[model samples]
Target: MAPQLTSLYTTSFLIALFVTLLVAACLRAINILPGRTCHSAKAPRKAAPATRILIVLGSGGHTHEMFHLLRDLDTSRYTQRTYIVSGGDAFSAQRAVEFEQTLEDRASETRNKATTVRRRGTERPLCVGAEHFNIATIPRARKIHQSLLTTPFTSLVTLVSAFSPLFRSDRLHPNLPPTTPYEIAAQDLPDLIITNGPATGVIVVLAALIAKFFNLKGCSSRSKCRTIYVESFARVKTLSLSAKLLAGVVDRFLVQWEELEGEGGYVGGHAEYWGILV
Candidate 1:
């Protein structure tokens, strides 16, 4: 009789587990259906639009190094670029503009030289890439050893600002077309988000990841909002606080040094030691 009772209990537990799993699966399917449907209908786009790229700048060396990286990028490919800088960072904004101008000037020089060499007006048009990059600012989330009492409030505000640009697109891009009712749904989330370690980056990245999770605006692909986190060149042996925190969410965690590879304690994917990016 005891053995029979045990058998009955096991059978009941299995049934309950199966029901729970079935319900959960159904709910998941319902939630994912909308994104999947839209993705399928729009996928295999005949001609993919230019990728919208966002680069988060953390003042000082972060800005300088990234400037070189951006300058070298193929502007024709990444047509829409957004630069996120922490508030009160006038230098970064200025630098971004300068970077743009530098490319333009160089392009002109190259074009003229080509024209001169060709002995006619057969030179190709300028290939200025930096002009595509746009800049926006967010307040810093924390200071080194910031007081715990006030950290939460600042962090909260910073996080909001990271997502705040959604409501006001014109303010960022004055030339943008008139927004429509579907503006909110069809908003352009960055196709690619790239950043290096800085306390401020943590918030911006976190916001992007959350938006991706919900299949919200600006995510080009329903299944992913590609984020790449490059460890600071300064840290050759260890990951910084921001890098470590962002390891799980970033689609790619790039290490500048060979030794630091696989140190993130995350199996999200193999950490690539791409050597120096700057």
Candidate 2:
């Protein structure tokens, strides 16, 4: 009887091991498969005129982190940039205006002084009224520290409004024919999205993921609409509520604190611990 029991246990262990391996293999294949119902992951993508980027600004510290990150980004690599902020956030809008103009001026000086590119008369991005940049506002998902229950309804409403900017016509180009937001967003949706914790980040990130899932607004490709969520520097030992909620969905989840790096239940299995984004 003892021998029989040992043999049964061994057999069961082998079956479980085999099942686990098979499941892991299947999941790996699915992970590599890019989105788009009829799209081929192997197909070559056409490079657009310029790479578009969207940066979400959360009121105070988040805005500071983003501003520093934005300043360092190779502006030459990004032709157009968009800043997303919650409605009534005049501070964020003001920061964006000031920061974008600074960027423009810096790039212009580089161009004006360049012995190579300027010889070819390559035009620099204009500082004028932020033509190459836009400030998009969506209603706040819910006020800070509010109960989680009230959020679902507000979050749902915020989710729909989050997509509005992607569909909005560039009021700048009135001479251009009337264009649907989907068409415009599909053609020029951001290739990269950066954000720190906030209800605003949660909504926008979810919207981007949903858009990619449905292959709507041409942001279906992860390469075209990748989301990077950086946990707040203020978080020391544990993740903030916003980061915890977004950990499962965002493409890259970065934690500012090293101690919280190995928190359990992270959907990606691990979080990259990049010390202090600010």
Candidate 3:
């Protein structure tokens, strides 16, 4: 009878602890998640001298669409670009390099065409160089034809690996202090994170959430790592799995179709439609 009572008490204590942890997680999520209304129009409280942007690229279609969405990206404003791709995804890495080359070429052409000496503050210089961008590879959350029963283990691995790129690594400049703008950007949290519906995208965003929840590197306090998720143009009626999962968490959830707007019953309200971006 004593043993039975001890078991019961132990079970009750575990249950109580579980409930406490669940409540704490919920409160933290609420505090960090973005609100329903879009705040992109508002000016930032304090702008950094150099801005860094992290872009997550997926395989095939997702990668194709992401570049299209960023076709008009102003390299001058986003001074540094970090491209994150899953391991063994050479195509995406190559694409990122090609994109940077294009930016560099465009900058060169603009400089050649300029007839007058540019005055200070009139226009920012183009951030076009190999020094301004980097490509990082992380393990895939799940491989093709992988068993679902073991997925949680692999996803956890992916989540843990995702945080490395989010934080500034000292390995970037091991021997010397960062002096240039590009070097400084490399050692700071990204100002923005952009992704489309990819398996790895969800994991990266979840990692960002965890960092913000703990205020890792002052992510939340500095208002850095703001995320934007764009739904695929093909999803006309319903949200994609990644879109649904991220609707409440990302700073902006944009759908190409009008039908998908207001679809997700998120605590932050509804998804937004800004026409077909891709």
Model 1: CA > 4 A from native? 1-49, 113-131, 166-187, 218-224
Model 1 TM: 0.70
Looking at model 3, the pairs that clash are none
Candidate 1, lDDT over the whole model: 0.66
True lDDT of residue 24, candidate 3: 97
C-alpha-based local distance difference test score of model 3: 0.86
Q: What would the per-residue lDDT of candidate 3 be over residues 1-278, giving only the tens digit for each residue?
A: 35766665687789998999999988987888886555665476644557999999999899999999998888888888889999999999999999899889988888887756665665777888867888989999999999999999999999998888889633455788899877888888898999998999999999999889999999999888999999989898878889989888888888999888777746634688889997
Candidate 2 — which pairs collide? Answer: 167-181, 186-217
Candidate 1 lDDT, 1-278, residue by residue in tens? 34755665687788998999999766653443233123225446432334566778887888887776566765545555677888888998898888778877776777677666755554223334533455788888876688999999999999999886432322333467535322322246666677887777778777876675455753424543467788878888777888888776566777888898767734433457767877
Steric clashes per prediction: 2, 2, 0
What are the lDDT figures for the candidates, one per model? 0.66, 0.69, 0.86
Candidate 3: stretches off by over 4 Å: 1-22, 38-42, 45-47, 116-120, 169-173
- TM-score winner, 2 or 3: 3
Off by over 4 Å in 2: 1-48, 116-129, 144-149, 167-169, 178-187
Give the alpha carbon lDDT tens digit for every residue of 1-278 in model 2.
35765665687788998999889766653553332321223457654445667888888778987787666666655656778889888999999989877887787777677756535555434332355678898888887797999988887888998887654424566667536432344246677778887678888888877676566755554456777778877788888888887766666677777888855234344467767766
**How close to the true structure is residue 162 of candidate 1, measured as C-alpha lDDT?**
88
lDDT at 225, model 2: 74
Give residue 192's lDDT in candidate 3 (0 to 100).
94
